[model samples]
Target: MEETINLKELFQILRKRLLMILAVTFTAVLASAIVSFYFITPIYQSSTQILVNQKKADNSIVQYNEVQTNVQLVNTYSIIIKSPAILDQVKKQLNLDMSVQELTNKINVASEKDSQVFSVTVQDAKPELAKDIANTTAAVFKEEVAKIMSVDNVSILSIAEVAKEQSPIKPQPMLNIAIAFVVGLMVSVGLAFLLEYLDNTIKREQDIEKILELPVLGVVTKMEEKKAAAAAVTKVREQTIGS
Candidate 1:
């Protein structure tokens, strides 16, 4: 019974503040949509893939050990691809205005473990620039790795290309609004309970009972002036009869 009553009270509190919660949630979603669509800058992404393979020393077919070695080198190659030697050349070839560190920050290299193929992804404000950066970085890395590693095993599998209709990869307004909706609902519900907890003024019979730990005896109703005069006379008459 106590658990049911507590649940009822909680439901009542939430119901009383439902409008406030909805309003807050709506406001939060609207703000997120506006920021996502207008305030945040869109970023476009492009990627190029490169393959690593060792050349056969003789006419005989390549061994599995050599293939494994090439796969292991992918980790080192991923690092070297982001190094200054590769990025500096990439910057020079592209005539980019950014520094090597800035260019490095924009590039991402990823490959599955034991995979001979790796990818270089680039993000920029412009789709063309992203495509150019991805392609140029791969070309420079392929050329420099041969000299640095003393081998010609790196080969370009694919180059980044701009599509006829390109789209940005970031600043998704729908996703932002969805996140805001959940966050706003949680915050608003918590705020409602907090406000309810802090309110101490007694406004109901149950509040009085809970505070006093006693039952209410009776309620004295207020009357108009004419009704008060009539009641006073009736009280006197009843007292006279009792006497």
Candidate 2:
């Protein structure tokens, strides 16, 4: 016969292995918490904003065409900001021990679509270092962009600053734990069903009859049940004798 599982069987399997499922899930959540809180190093973030606007030589108001041009240049400027030209100067000024390539990995230059305002973001293990890198990168980019492109358009709108209670941007413990909980639940439930499928030993009268292809004429009582019945009979006999 083609065998199929129903909702009741599914629930029964889950219920039978409920404690194992909970233990696994709890272990996963605990491991995630421990790793996130103690093992993983937190990454701190800092960012500085810069505005890309063209300067009019005649000292007049900026026009739409200039703004559009500046917006188009943001992509090119993003690359230049992380280039060796700007990073080299930043390293020298900051006296950083890391190489230019390593420093480039920590910096990111980004801007919104069709917008002239771009931001320089830096990430590091130290909050103060992150803030300093952000500000220094923006400063270097602003000064160097003029010399490289022969235009004085970039303006520093904001600089990065470290707060007293700065929080790390990476290794979120709660989120990690939540993901662990979901994965653990799925794995544990799957294991429970797998064990249920693997178990082929007879557990009931129906199993015996089904496997043997014969009718079950009688059922044998358990030893504990027989002992309990004999004890009850002996108690009744004692009571009758006393009467």
Give the worst 10-residue stretch by lDDT in candidate 2. Answer: 1-10
For candidate 1, the 10 contiguous residues with the lowest summed lDDT are 54-63
lDDT value for model 1: 0.92
State which candidate has the highest lDDT.
1
Top TM-score: which candidate number?
1
- The TM-score values for the models, in the order shown, are 0.89, 0.86
For model 1, what is the alpha-carbon lDDT of residue 150? Answer: 98
